[model samples]
Target: MEVVSEDIPVVIAFTPNYFVPVATCISSVLRNADEDARFHFICLLTEALPEHMQQLLNELVGELGRFTFMDLTGTLSADIYVDPKYTIAASYRLLLPDLLPQYDKVLYIDCDMIFRNDLSELYHRVDLDDNYMAGVFEATLEQQLAHMQVIGCAPGTYINSGLLLMNLKKLREDGMVAKFLEAATQEGLEFPDQDVINQLCKGRIIGLPPFWNSIRTFLLPQYKADFLRFYTEQDWQTVQRKGNVHYTGPKPWKTFTVAFDLWWRYYFKLPKPMQALLIIPTKLSLLAKIYQTFLGKTILDGTRALYRKLKRNEG
Candidate 1:
């Protein structure tokens, strides 16, 4: 397929362990995209893919859209501290402007999400003339303020980095990469890459609608009050319509959640072999938990109850 200038450029980063999640993410996007829509995917890798995984990825890329594998080794300096919890690949998004100068715009999406509708609307809808990038605001003002303090950005300027519509030309013109690198090296942030992006592009980051990046935090009971306080009923309705559900914590493949079923629906759509390889672990894990619960209730607890009942009858 000839990649036209109008084709949207998407970038996703992952380590070797994340191949399955990234595959599911790409599959979900293609499934929902318009028939003629084109996407040029840039896969930033912390390590090279295994041969089998590479073959699977190649097949998927060949069938759906164009892709390029970017090796991230030796590219970023060690002074940039990536938290042990997150892979170094998370920081690769900062390199996009310098890496893809041919494109005026690019979209960065986390691998831990699934698209519910065509992304062409999001790509074409958000205006990026004056903004460095467009992203959904953090869930609460307090969280946003905390991030703002870490990055020295103004309140409400902080955004979740899971989904971003980047203005690559403008960022490149401003030498944002150098600035981001300086800030990242100087400061140890709670969310390193995201904070650096917010700090460097503070006033220039526009807040898009929440539906574009529906974070899992909003659905948790602890955050429900904050969710309601920040968003209106209409906003919630919009999320239901076309929101890209981001599995920010406890991925569906590892554990079951309200969204796990949705993730599996897309997983099942994959070729049978791929499905078997990926789904078995999740299914077995769930079954193991169920079996443990059954044993505790029927074997251990049941014997204890029986002993208690006999003692009461003797009394």
Candidate 2:
């Protein structure tokens, strides 16, 4: 079926390497959405997808929703600084206003996430009357304040770009795309695209509730202090209420975590052959992590014993 203008347009950007996870993401969204819900996915690609993968994506999109694959290779200028940690796809969201000018608004979601709630609620309920975009605030006030300073924006304006609701008309009218690209070229940002979005949008962004873009902060103990430093009890409760889960740290596919099962529940829905190919690398990666941890522990234990013996001899 053709995607009508009335249907919500959701955008995701990723390289060919993340095809499975992106497929899983779309599958999860389809599973959670209402039967009558309509969505048009705009997949901005940094590289060409494999034939098998393209077939898989087509099968998934069949009759459920509409999708458009956009090749963004060689679109960005050489001067734009891309973080080594991320692919060029990470910056693709910056081009939406220019590439998709027909749409008034579009939702940009990261491939490393799963949808647990109906997206229609988010699409229709949030009012972007005067803002360029909407997103959940970053988890930490300190980080928010720091980034705000970096962009010279006020406090409480920093937001995560992982799941963004962009007002395309407003963005284009304000010339934010050029501004963001200019900032990217000049600044040494840790998260280049995200920093540019938060910096440029500033007070123009509407703060969505935490439920909309809940990062998996509760899963890691090391992050607890930072999480608590920013999020309140109510914020944690919102996360529990089942919104979009951003698998930020170690992806569930690569290792076992609190949310690994949740991710696998959707992964198993894929074709059996795909399951076989995907699980092997994930299991091997887990084993590799375990082996590295054990080796480091043994080396530390041996060093500690030698240090104690030396201390005793000195005594």
Candidate 3:
């Protein structure tokens, strides 16, 4: 099934810790890609190499067949430190704006994603008219705009940060990246990196259907349509058509089992005994979380996810 690079139109993703699960998800998508447009998938790691991780990374690279690696701190223009408070996942916010220049149109996926089909279709779907950037309509563009205003960006622009197909050429030409960095600084009211892109590219960015980034497609509770105007049906019609499933929420790693059971299948040539050990804990954690997710048959929502903190506070 593997062919030489195939000179595919590029797709990029970034991950810290060199996650094997995410790498598997990414590879699965690439494997199914059209030969005409093979994938140029690139990923980044945010930390110094640990011996175990180093070996794992090597194994990942070997199994990947074709992919690129970029060390986080090594590639940045300047050292970015968001309040040393929470081990900030902020470097990605800083790095993305700068990294946008390196390619034409890049698909930047979060580490917690899986690929259901060849990304070539989505890559082709990006239509940059009206300054719109493609992503789901969840918390619709209107709500996204409200969030943007809070962060000092023009309203009506906000995209889900999880999986972004960025048009780097357009971004550079419009001076959006510089603007994003300025808006994203520590002193300048902290907004997530995804919000910045949504704000800056509002109105002009196109909206992809909800299926491409189906945050709650399978995981969340389902509901029926209005049956009158056909509006809800329209959304479902759009949803029925898609090629990828993005598992973007409290992942199975913290819980007893990941939502999509599909993520459990990724692997390398590592010894079976070693894999057995790794998967066992991963599965156990997922199982334990399923109970934790439930508060008497109702999945915990919002602040309840911070049960540990609640205990500390109570203590």
Candidate 4:
């Protein structure tokens, strides 16, 4: 193993269709990083990333540190049950211990988020010596009961897998890959890899404040009561001050919200022409909202059903 260096190794996994948000995510990090921050990015993908995108990534990370891309096509087991909403790319983070043996620890974040402050604090300050990984709690104790039962984890320990400070050395020593594979084969796993991680690393996960991976819903009046009960007052202040926003439910390009506005603030940093192309989803979402408001979901569902039936008949 190489000597543990000060440079942070940050990992992200995404598909081709998510390039816009990927770029935006990276941009937020590069732009907001502290002056002394140094990073090494490892992007995992299943398909061959286009050269232009690779070049753009290089340009984005220029002089900051290295930006490496690994195509992980066919890397996951065929038997691993991937949820319909997620692709095989979702499991690519599981390969980190093997793929990045040189690094003792690494930060893995989803591409659907943007940083509000320098990540140096997270990469340097968090102690993962005794734990396999550290992450923020994803739900209230009541809400986590079902997931905890599914994964056999204790209450308040179930974490959102979106942002993680992974102790790769510990995971490698524990042979986590095999354990993950075994858990992947288990029945009644709703969250696929997330369940596997929680089940395998139970009682070993260090819980961070929710600010680090603040979902937009936490800011809503309906959820804030539960959010406050689940987390500390400092956590709420940290999120309010400056923390990365995770677009867990609705993406910014497809909907408008305080969190989406934060996303747009960073996204607009890209060239004007490309920005135009990215807002198409927002336009379509607006149109859908208008259609639903006037005609209702019943009409929309019936229309979709009729369209699908017609297509099937034509086929």
| Model 1 lDDT tens row, 1-315 | 245675778899998777778888889999888877878888898887677877787777675567778887989998987877788899999888898878888889999999987787789877899789999986565655665665686544568999999999999998989888877776457888988887778778888878888888654434555666667767776775667889988887786553555676677567665665554575645543443454633664455557757876897
- lDDT of all the models against the reference? 0.77, 0.77, 0.50, 0.78
TM-score of each: 0.84, 0.83, 0.65, 0.84
Task: List candidate 4 stretches off by more than 4 Å.
Answer: 1-6, 141-144, 272-315
Candidate 4 is scored at a TM of: 0.84
The Cα RMSD in angstroms, rounded to one decimal, for candidate 1 relative to the true structure is 7.7
Candidate 1 residue pairs in backbone clash = none
Q: Which pairs of residues clash in candidate 2, taking residues 3 or more apart in a chain or in different chains? A: none
lDDT of 3 by residue, 244-274 (tens): 5555555554443233334544433334533
lDDT of 4 by residue, 64-179 (tens): 86777889888887888888878888788777889898888999999999988778888889999879999987755466577677667766677778899999999999899887
Candidate order by lDDT, decreasing, is 4, 1, 2, 3
lDDT per residue for candidate 2 within 1-315, as digits (tens), equals 244866789899988778889988988888988877878988899877667776777777788777788877899999889988888888889888989977889899999988898887788889999899899876564545665676675654568789999999998998888998888886478789988887678778888877778777643334556656566667666676675788877887776444555676677777765555564475644543443455844664566558757876897
lDDT for model 2 comes to 0.77
Candidate 3 TM-score over all chains jointly: 0.65
Between candidates 1 and 3, the lDDT winner: 1
lDDT of 1 at 173: 91
